[model samples]
Target: MSALVARPFRLLGEGAVRAVRTALMQAVSAWTADWGLAPALVDVDVHRAWDGTSARALAWNHGAQSNGRRAWLAVGPDVATGLQQMMFPADPSYGPVGSATPALAAAGALQALDALLDALLRTSLSSQHNVPRCGAAVPATSWEYGSGALVARLAFGSRHFHVLLDGPAVQALVPPAAPLPALRAVDVAAGVADVPVSLRLQAGTARVGVGALLSLAPGDVIRLDKQADAPLTLASMSSHPLFHAYLGRCRDEVAVELVQSHTPVGEVQ
Candidate 1:
């Protein structure tokens, strides 16, 4: 005895769904005039399986290198009858020959359906190596149900129908993810190493009234905000402090010895 294992149903991603929907809508809109039928896309979705009991379907295969991928376009009884009536209106003068309406409508609709399949395949296989082509119509009963498939609902002159793409067909439309570039260590100091930057040193500051400042004469002492023992701030031209330094003498000339690095509040070192 052989054991049967059930596989989990995989739903189509958002990107794949959008792509199929857009392709179908575009194809219908483009060929509406030539098709002689006004078509509109109602909905596009994913379904586990298609119920073929009460629906008539046209099956086709397409692939880049081989015609192994399969898809189906199906319509309910009402849609089929509507298509028959639309393709062959009642001609009372031609009495018995009117019985052939169903067959004639099916044959005529095949061309339009094939065109839709071509449009979908062209869009999905654009990035692939070989251009995809649709094979001749196959028997709908021959189509094997997969774990899940994409189903598109379309309305043509009040008649609604469905287009289904099998798992392999849906996968063909999904674009491959691009590879990320390799990461490398960056030289933190190389780019700015040669750039010139101007720095300033601030010894102390004081706030005085305009009158008092104007009245100040030579030899008059002005008190500063900083303590005498405090180190001065070494900053950039923009007045951003970079370091703390103490005023000192180097070889009898005035100099500043860096005591510590200065970091502004709320700033990382």
Candidate 2:
């Protein structure tokens, strides 16, 4: 009875999904143009399933072989049969598994894919999945095959960079980020002769328990844990450190400028 039920929506959705996959496959070919791979050698193919899953293949560089042939390129769902997949698979099987044809060398195709992945990972459409000892599974959104298991498996491909599996996965690849500016303090001065004792700078007061507060009496000193030599900190509304300067007077006027900062002004340390 269940098998006889209508499943039109599922079928329609799967068809739409495959159409989108085909479009993305074309985009992959255009995207890899920077890799300078021969377009003639590359052939993008699409495989769709009754289930919502789909796979796209691009032959980056392929050629005839003694027995079989294969295609290679930047994007594919079947990492096993896909050139890049064969080279770096989550469940790596080095030899052969499926059909053969004029295929690209899995190793060389991977090198190109590696560069592209590095870029894709920087973007939002990419994800990395650790497939145990079989290396990493770096599948870009263009390589998406409509599986929650596949998406959940994304992990960081390279050791460096903020590239990750589930974070911002934008499709367009952006350049690597630059290093943050270092912190620097402005002019600072400590005690000097004849400075007004009552003019001593004060840090923000902290609240204590009711019992502790009531215990305080006139002439009773409560020494704070803050070090006396600690630079006076000025913070912006954003909680970012703006500057650090010692309390001092320059001809009856306090002044501060570039000296050294625990962190750069206007910059988060």
Candidate RMSDs in Å, in order, are 12.7, 21.2
lDDT of 1 at 125: 38
Position 172, candidate 1: lDDT: 66
Alpha-carbon local distance difference test for all models: 0.60, 0.37
lDDT of 1 by residue, 130-202 (tens): 3445444534433345444566666655777666565666666666668999989787578666888877887
lDDT of 2 by residue, 45-164 (tens): 333222243222223221111111111223333432353443444544454557763255565655655554443332224223311112233334323333211111111222111112
Candidate 1 regions off by >4 Å?
Answer: 1-77, 82-173, 183-185, 227-229, 236-241, 248-255, 263-269
Q: What is the TM-score of each candidate against the true structure?
A: 0.42, 0.22
Model 1 scores a TM of 0.42
Worst 10 residues of 2 by lDDT: 62-71
- In candidate 2, stretches whose alpha carbon ends up further than 4 angstroms from where it belongs are 1-9, 13-18, 51-109, 116-269
